[model samples]
Target: MTMEHGRAAGTTRKPKVVFVLGATATGKSKLAVAIAKRFDGEVVNADKIQVHAGAPVITNKVTEEDMAGVPHHLLGVLPADAEFTAEDFRRKAGRAVARVLAAGRLPVVAGGSNTYIEELVDRDNAAFRERYDALFVWTDAEPEVLDWYVALRVDDMVARGLVNEARAVFVPDDADYTRGVRRAIGLPEMHGYLLAEREGGAGEEELLALLARAVGEIKENTCRLARAQAGKIRRLSGLEGWDVRRVDVTPVFACMKDGGAACHQETWRKLVWEPCQEMVRSFLEAPGCRPCSSIRPARR
Candidate 1:
């Protein structure tokens, strides 16, 4: 991989990557698309669920419309039943970043899957530091705020055909949930309800009860996932010394919950979008990394 536009004149510089990372449902993906547009960049998915094929609704994969025509890699490219690991992600993500750099575009790795990020960024910190200048942006919200938003998003997903999408991938006889798209949150949560409905021997009231229970489980599990993801980011930032620039987007969420659609857009630009644009601007303008005794970030 070579650094093209990220370089200055004839000077060879390390390839630059900005990671948009944080807990689920924190608008990380949307912010990433905006960043890519501002910086002539492409997004590479690091979210494990999103790598699997199909089940977009359940896995919460960003759609083409959401991606806004920005080139995306490692997203929805794996077979639905394939088992993917952090090591697998590291190899694929490295190639994806290289391809973006070769095309003279900045590379933005965006997702909630922190292990994949860790594998790519920290597994070989010394060599990684030598080869790339990286900026880590953590888009965060208050835990309580996120708890509300996640449940709301799960409802929205269901309204947008989450149950049907999950049904399409449902396996009635087999309930392994250990690997592949079946392991996605919505699929496992919906298993009991889907199986019961498919079997067609249950009463109407019983089916409704099971379905409601399934939806509740989906919401609760997703909330738990957001918490776990946040914990991982904390570990990476604190124990591993990742220089993560955290931007609390709680205002954006709070406003969305109460404000009109028009106000929502305005609040987003002011509180989340504009600030991130400036952060990436400054990082790009900064000099590339120099070899040092340590790659650890200074304590925040």
Candidate 2:
């Protein structure tokens, strides 16, 4: 189904959807914003954790200033305590794409939440099969380098008051970490530290040790999550037969280590931004291009 743009006999022409998918801390948000600005599109977050309200530091959500006036949907729209299932996301995100299409703008869905993204993009439905044109641009980086990057991000989140953010929603006796935003990597790891902070106000040295251990655990767990996410992206690639254009941002991270933030930005523009923009432009204009799902193409 890589031809006829996914059209079928008696099938309605569906809207085009661009996807920016990758592991955590690989700069998917930045690239999504860049693609939106270039193609006059809006960003629809597919990250399940990011859809919850608050815990922005923990989730590493795109800040308002970073969005640069580009509209974003399904981002922090749900309550932090609310349960948002994959089916919930499928319904809402479908509406979001429709709204974007109604305004005659492209839809760029971006997030590391591959399961949620898969639910929305690969669901078996007659109208959905006939109605979507998907182009995925996956941003990836080497594990060692990206693990370092995610560690740095954990430190940055701490500096941004992640402990206090978790404290706001921390429950003392609750062992169930599988619900809502509490499932975020940082919060679950910090459970021990949060307990110490709440119960033992006098154990100065022990509390500090607990806090440090919690932060370290957060970094380690976050790196694990990133690896798992990368693996899931690979799984989706094989299972769904997607036409994925991968952009490696390892060089950008390396530049940051050698030069600094400025150098990293310059390297990113060259390695990640420019190529994605060109790819997006071609995707938007290419004829006979189609969403590479398993759906059989209609006979002409």
Best by lDDT, which number? Answer: 1
State the lDDT at 159 in candidate 1.
Answer: 95
Q: TM-score for all predictions?
A: 0.92, 0.89
| lDDT of predicted model 2 | 0.81
Error of 2 at 113 (Å): 1.0
Q: What residue runs in model 1 are displaced by over 4 Å at the alpha carbon?
A: 1-4, 10-12, 239-241, 288-300
Record all residue pairs in model 2 with backbone atoms less than 3 Å apart, i.e. clashing: none
Give the per-residue lDDT digits (tens) of candidate 2, residues 34-97.
Answer: 8888777889999888898888888888999999999999998888778999999889999998
Model 2 residue-pair collision total:
0
lDDT of 1 by residue, 1-300 (tens): 223546877667667789998899999899999999888899999999889899888888898899998999999998988989998998899989989989889999999989889888877654555678888888878889988999899999999999999888788887788887778898888888888899999999999899899999988998898889988887787744356777777887888889967877898898777777766776776653322221223224
lDDT: worst 10-residue window of model 2? 291-300
Candidate 2 stretches with Cα past 4 Å from truth are: 1-14, 126-129, 288-300
Clashes of each: 0, 0
Q: Report how far off residue 85 is in candidate 1 (Å).
A: 1.3
Clashing residue pairs for model 1? none
